[model samples]
Target: MTESYLLGIDVGGTSIKMAIFSNDGDLMEKWSIATNKEKDGEYILEDISVSVKEKWQEMDLQANQFIGAGVGVPGFVDIEHGTIDFAVNIGWRDYPISSILSQHLGLPVVVDNDANLAAAGEYWRGAGVDAEDLILLTLGTGVGGGIIVKGDILHGVAGMAGEIGHVTMIPEAGSPCNCGKSGCLETVASATGMVRMARETIEHNTNSRLYQIWQENGEITTKDIFACAENNDTEAVTIINNAMYYLGLATANIANVLNPEKIVIGGGVSGAGEDLLRPLRFYYDTYALPKVKEHSTFAVAELGNDAGVAGAAWAAKTKAK
Candidate 1:
């Protein structure tokens, strides 16, 4: 039997990931290209469309072999209208992404927020596989999240249900966030936030390893902080503790309400692995209700960069139904 394929596209601010997967979710081929954001991102759709055609031809595949395409966008989405409500990073507003991409590919296309799809990807194939309800946090340059309830992505009424990063953790005189809010969880638990915290506390711990590293490199990374914290560097441990505290607190609050089966953590910072999970779990236990903490488990995402594409492919499969 000739196999059908699903085209998965993950559109990020830095690059776009494209993958070909069997309708059953086996990854056949995958590659990435730099995101061209010129002219208000007018070229992104065309670039993706052209690239997919090239890859399809390279694989000796015909158009009819494809069931559909699913795209993950890094912005607020109007799932009902298949348009981007607004994406400040991509400079898109009221843009019809689904129709345009579909027209270009001659296939039905489905679109969703990038982070939400990542969560769905995790739930489908990664660490959250066994769980029907899950929460996924992507701790990158900023924070992003997706919530799954009984296996479907929860978009709420406005398709903004999983903006976990923007949840207010500090309401009074806290650092301002890109979302025009003060003291958002993103301002504490994200890489940017951790780095900022390191800089602020470095002076106070001038005799510590963290301060010494800062003096040598003039900067410190979340990785450096985690490594130092593991080695018992006071400042670094403090930074990690403080940031993960907010993360735990935020998730604990959310988990208290949702009582998800698993909470998956991904992104660059999560690469710290046990170093990150240790303090994070401690604080989560502190803030979460005893039953919720006991029942919900935390995990690291397994798919890495492949997650978005996998999630998008899964979304494509659903669109076919």
Candidate 2:
């Protein structure tokens, strides 16, 4: 008898991460490939299937040894049909990801939004493990999030639930977001948004340390901003504080409704660790209702980039069960 495994795939804008996990959920092997975005992303799924086949051969595993596959995609996913409604980054529209992958791999495939899988990953084996309910916020180039309620993902009526990034933060005189909206939470809390804010601040306050760093590096990043703020740069501190305000507001609102046990923050920006969490918790406590404030604990996500793949694998395991 051959040992069984599960395949997990995380599809991002730049790369596709694939992982193999034992039936008992231990990671076996993982790798990544460039995302072939040419020609409307028609080749992406085929590339994934081919990669899986190669990996299976390399591992010398029997075809039937793999129980199933799960995928996490960066788009609005329709779970019922295993189709992606739209993923601008990957240039996909109504793409039948699950069906194609299933047919190619000869295994059941489950698909979902990447952020949702990140949440699931955290809930299963990362920061929120053991929690029946939790939420995950990915604060990177763009803010993305997922909500899990009672061990299940919260897919709203339109399958866009847990989209905390789009929550309006500034109704007027706010920056425009990629979602075609102005003053969205993403416009202020995301890495891209934070860089934009830093640039704008530099225009008026050239004397700040952040301006000096930007002049030397020729670009300002979310990491630079956080580092400068840690060094007590006035401008950097103010910018981070502003971003935290909106982030806290959105998270608190969600907590009020879901009352999750843990709220896990992830992505590049979250690498700041305590520097980010302390202030974020301050604002979250300020805005969340009394019950929400009392119940939910904040923590940084532990799975990092592996969250998506881990969660995807978890999804496959659950679907197979």
Model 2: number of clashes? Answer: 0
Writing each residue's lDDT as its tens digit, candidate 2 over 217-241 gives 9999988998898889888898999
Cα lDDT of candidate 1 equals 0.90
Q: Candidate 2: TM-score?
A: 0.96
Off by over 4 Å in 1: 1-3
Tens-digit per-residue lDDT, 3-27, candidate 1: 3898889998889999999987789
TM-score, per-candidate, Cα-based: 0.96, 0.96
lDDT of each: 0.90, 0.91
The weakest ten consecutive residues by lDDT in model 2 span 312-321
TM-score of 1: 0.96
